[model samples]
Target: MGSLLFLAFAYLAVGQAAVNRNGAQTAADAAALAAAQDKRDQLAGKWVEEVLDPTQWQDIFDGFAPGLTPSCWRADQLASQNDAHVDGCVPGPLEFEVSVEMDNPVGDSIIPGTEGRYSTESAIAVIEPRCTFELPEEDAGDDVLPQLTCKDRNWDLDPEDLGDLPAPEDLFDVHLAD
Candidate 1:
């Protein structure tokens, strides 16, 4: 009876540990996906490929869990020693790993959400800039602080776009509309 009880307790303890490790790994994985998606979303007007770089996504990984290692699927931070991808993938389904490990985007994390039984499923993506426009910088007198001009930052007006040059009265109307 004593041996059976001891064996049962040992089994239960081992199972508990497995549960904790799995839970932590799940957390890391989910956070990685979230970070990747957010990183890509933020690069709407910048280089999509560079923004998706694993190294650049470190801060997002760190935010998932405070101390998860690269070995852990949901790392506290990145675990790219030499293998750089910003996507913290490793062996085991808990983390991102590939047979060749050439920075393949795979893996999932289970993070609980409010009023939900299923975990959040998210994937990283790159957002391309829909348009590109620039505004001329206003001349600033030599002052320590930058000047604050309330004028509109966008002044992309094509001379040809205006079929007929506006009169002085029309110019005032255009300025007032802006």
Candidate 2:
């Protein structure tokens, strides 16, 4: 009877740890995705700014403005929302790698050092741009038009098309790489 009871308790503890580890993984995934999404939004905003004034388009394309919201900030916010804390957030060119540690630990178990130890998980997300800007040729005419190519569709500076421009998600593809 004593051995059976101990075995049951041990299984329960292992199950709890598994649950905590899964939660930590979830937090890391969410944080990474959020940061990547933020970067994608920044790219879309730059596209809009260039659209407003084609003259500044080259500069914007060559060297874009800094993001209004830092990727680390977005990751931290997401981790907290998931009952975890951001252990690390590193932004690479259109990608964010995040490591999160669970705030709630698995219950004490027979395994030594299991108490008060949090599970940590890491995830990576990448953003792929769906649009490319090709500068229009210099013209003598007053009207200067730039080419906006996205998703195999050429878009001019038409007000209706501009208004119907693809959403940020459409302009960028964000997904978990690992």
lDDT for every model? 0.30, 0.79
Tens-digit lDDT track of model 2 for 3-107: 999899889889989999999999999999999888778877876865656666454343355554676888999999999999999988778999999988776
State, as a TM-score between 0 and 1, how close model 2 is to the true structure.
0.81
- Model 1, 7-90: lDDT tens digits are 786666556445544444444344454333333333321222222232332332222322333333222233232122233333
Q: Which stretches of candidate 1 lie over 4 Å from their true place?
A: 45-178
- Clash pairs (backbone) in predicted model 2: none
In angstroms, the error of model 2 at 81 is 1.1
Candidates in order, TM-scores: namely: 0.29, 0.81
Where's the lowest-lDDT run of ten residues in candidate 1? Answer: 169-178
